[model samples]
Target: MIERLQLLVAERERVLGHFLESEQREIALACHSIARAFSRGGTLVAYGVDSAETDAAHVAVEFMHPVIVGKRALPALAPPNDVRGVLRSGDIAVSIAHGAEPAPVRAFREQARHRGALTIALTGGDRVDSDHAFAVPSEDPQVVQEVQETLYHVFWELVHVFFEHPGLLDDACITCGDVAIQARVVAVRNGNAVIEKDGLREEVAVELVAPVDVGDMLLCHAGVALERVE
Candidate 1:
């Protein structure tokens, strides 16, 4: 019994270490994106099929009723029906699955993406069509679920870091005249551009200029770039 327990503990630790090391950057970026979504008054919609339903519910509750005191509650829910029914643009869509995501979950995630929601997939190391995907290193269903649970809890904790800094998120109400602001594109990802102006960085929609690249200067207004500055 002691040997069996020790082996299980060791495997869990090994898998967790690998998961964290491989997914640290992805995890950070996902948290920031979730924070930005909340800043834009977007809700988080968590969903899954079968046993994964438990994880979806856990994520919703954690965001809607934070465990840490003084942290503001964020809008989140695990819809009992199709996630697409509640998904909206700028919202965050999260799906939990083990190895081989069910067809329905994949379909729902795709639908959410089509509707302009930020998609997050917690799966067992499968390539998913999402803005951010974090996979546990182990294929063991129990291990995968446990690590994903930890990931979401970490997400809940780290997302607050961005909220503490107001400048990191876009301010929708800050607009004056028809004039636009010129900013240098620092980074671009998933239809959004991270632009820097006088050392202040902000994300703006770059869909109008689909081919935006780093170091490109753009004319931005109302949280979206109108065109490139030549």
Candidate 2:
């Protein structure tokens, strides 16, 4: 029993270490997206059910009640008993789910899409079955749960980073490559697979930097590797 417990502890340490290793990249991606939303004057709304509710609440509290004064307090709303408020375009709905395909999550996702808000789903699944789920990739249930917490805190930290570099996003709006907008993946004809981006279903090439499987969502902007979604 003691040995098993020790092994679990060791595993957790490894998982946390891995998350830390990728911290910089994750921070960059998170800050970039948050900046994009903020640029358009959007608020952040976090929502989660079950155990993940704590994460949602944390996001809300941090923004609503900052510990330090004179700091930028973003308009962050948390999961409510009822989600009826139609937030602005700069608003975001972040969810943490193990399966990544649940009714509550889907409801929030649909609402965000309808309201023209961003949907950031932190998921722990081998494959993402939802329309847009950011796969954190965890096999162990405990690790999945713990990693969700890790990612939530990390994302909050990145939000602070974005605030520091406010000028970078607001000032220069560079033209990201247009590859994603014009990408397509088509069926192989004879010996080659053709890629098209003209809205053809099967012949649309997805310029994904990471290997994409049967189910995944590409958060593509001009074919740049901003972030991977499923």
Candidate 3:
């Protein structure tokens, strides 16, 4: 029994460490996008099939009624049985699927995308063409679901952070208007740039811009530093 417990802890730690190391930037970007959508009066619509339905419902509830005290409740809904006409432009759609990506989930994502909603998919490594596809790298179904649960919880939390910092989403920074938002590069690794903006640190993909160095001021957009602020 002790050996089994050790093995379980070891596997979970391995997977959790890998996810944190590899997917932090992606998760941050997703949170920024979702927060922007909410700021624009959008809603979060979640759905799942079979065993994944519970997760979908749980996501909706968490968003609509935050468990944390003082966290603002945002609008969220989970479609019952069918998702037709439930999504609209400026909404954020989340599809939760275990094992393989089901056909129904794919169709729902497509429909949501066509309606101009940002789509997020949590699947078992199968491509679902979502705006943000978080593939669970683990082969074990249990581990995959556990990782996905943690992922969504992180999403929910960080999105609130973005809400707290609305300046990060302003168009002035993207258009180089009078308000020039800049962040100092604290570190760079594997093409991901970590920057400190407004006293908050975030990791953004910097491949679209020129060579960056530590302490350089960068012009950021949608969680990515598009260029160096000269």
Candidate 4:
């Protein structure tokens, strides 16, 4: 068991090593896409189909989380949770799927693209060629799940750089106006938890509506919070 565990850790490191090796280029590509979308006044949308839902949420949280660079108070809209909600085109979508496009993601992308969003597809190693695929090139049967999860994070980390160092947009949002808004938490908070936004890390104000914790992606605006990012 110990040997297997060690092997797994090594393999995981190799995957990350590849990521680090290409960080500069990957960040360039990802930031370029993000800036292009933002230049057109686009929203960032994230979602996953079936089991990939968790990855979708992770992508959104990483972007919206405090101190994570492009950490906007902007609420990430997931179409499956609210079918009637709008996801217009020009929005950026970080989608995940192992082999094929999931139904929920397909539906959401359809709506988003029709509205004019640019899609960034993050697929598993098993997936066929995807122009938008952020390839990790791993085939560890014991760590398929880990690879899928990593794929989600690797892209978003690049997304963060896109907002901070801004290789592509060149800090376009520096002068952009803010959309003043507010929200309230719908649940509760236990232990040490806080709300993060706009590089301003503030402790979650309300408990009932501020049900978030470490690693959770929350939607915050004007002291009102809602829709945990998972």
Candidate 5:
């Protein structure tokens, strides 16, 4: 009995190590994509089969209510049973499947693709057909699920990094000042203004006292353009 338990622990560790080494780059790229989707007002939709159902729900709730204070809440949902008609264009569809990839999950991924949504598959199968696929590379179902929970948590954390450092993602090259940040107005659309600070640019909600135009300089705060700067 003792020998069997020792072997199980060793096997689990080996599988987790292999997964982390092999999937690191793919995981980074997926997190970047998820962050971009959220910035564009996209939602995360997760689905799973059998024991994975609870994981799907957990992922949704974590995004909707982050434990870390000051982190912005992002939208997420896990549909019970069928995921059909719930996904839309610009949304993200995450399918979590253990052992063989389930038929319904595969079909849902395909449908999401047709609707212009990003598809991510976490599975213990040969491979999942999607924009991004992470094969856990574990024969043991429990090991696969355990690694998957860690993977999704990592995803959630990394996605927030992009939000926190918008300047890094947007390649903004500007110095900050007391009270407000200086930016060049790049475009004005639908009552919001896209501003370039240094070289980086992002859309900011604005209620201009006077009309503003592209190439104007403005002061921004908390993603809102407060006033034009000389």
Candidate 6:
């Protein structure tokens, strides 16, 4: 029994590690989009099929009532039936499926897309159609669900990163006096750079600090790079 437990633990680690490595960038992007939606006063509507129903409720609670001290609550919900009538533009739709893709989940995501809402699909099978689909690279339903649980938790925790930089949000146009956060550059595109700090990611204008590359640290304020930190 002890040996079997160890094997199971090792397998879980392998599956989780591989997923993080492959989906790290995508996860960050999804978090960024989620934060944007929340900042714009949009709600998160989640639904799950089969065993994932519990996951939908868990994610909703985590976002609506944050566990971390000082973290503000965000709008999230898990509706019992079809959310097509509930979703609106700028809202977020999350569809969770453990192993098989059901018709309702598919229609939920499709309607979300058509309504201009951000769609995220978490499933164990490939070929999901959504703006951000994370398919766990595992055949076992239990392992896939576990990994997806971790994924949504990560979303709940890191979505607050964008909140820290209010100036980075389009809906927030406030002056942050003498406040500059340090972040490491992860990706550079045109005049903007994607930065990460403590698992929170944001893209700020780096035109002022031209020629900055990935792995460089910079001090940012009001959605713009102040200077490169040596």
Candidate 5 lDDT over residue span 1-99, tens digit each: 999999999998898899989989778877876887888889999998789889899999989999999998999999897785888877989988877
Candidate 3: clashing pairs of residues: none
TM-score of each: 0.77, 0.66, 0.74, 0.56, 0.72, 0.73
- The TM-score of predicted model 3 comes to 0.74
Q: Compared with the true structure, what per-residue lDDT tens digits does model 4 show for residues 1-230?
A: 99998987998888767755764454455556665566557767777767666666776666566454436544455555843255665577666665456666666655654444555665545332211345445654335456657655555555555566545564323112355223222212232233433422333444544435445655544443444554
Residue-level lDDT of model 3, residues 1-230, one tens digit each, is 99999999899889878977888887887798798889888999998888888999989998998989999999999987788488888899999887788888888888887777878889876645666778877778788788888988999999999878889866333323455357888655445665765434566778878588777888876777778877
RMSD of 6: 8.4
Model 5, C-alpha of 115: deviation from truth (Å): 0.7
Report how far off residue 58 is in candidate 4 (Å).
2.1
lDDT (C-alpha) at residue 221 in model 5: 75
lDDT minimum window of 10 residues, candidate 5: 168-177
Model 1: pairs clashing at backbone N, Cα or C within 3 Å = none
Residue 158 of model 2, lDDT score = 71
Superposition error at 102 for model 3 (Å):
0.3
Model 2, span 1-230: residue lDDT tens: 99999999989888777766754554455556675576677877877777667767876787677677776777778856555365565477676665455678667766665665656777666433322245655677668778777766666677777678776566331214443333332222222222323322222223444344433434445324344443
Those runs of model 2 whose alpha carbons end farther than 4 Å from true positions after fitting are: 19-27, 68-70, 126-133, 171-173, 176-230
Alpha-carbon shift of residue 96 in model 2 (angstroms)? 1.8
Which lDDT values do the candidates have, in the order given?
Answer: 0.83, 0.58, 0.80, 0.53, 0.80, 0.83
Least well predicted 10-residue stretch by lDDT in candidate 3: 171-180
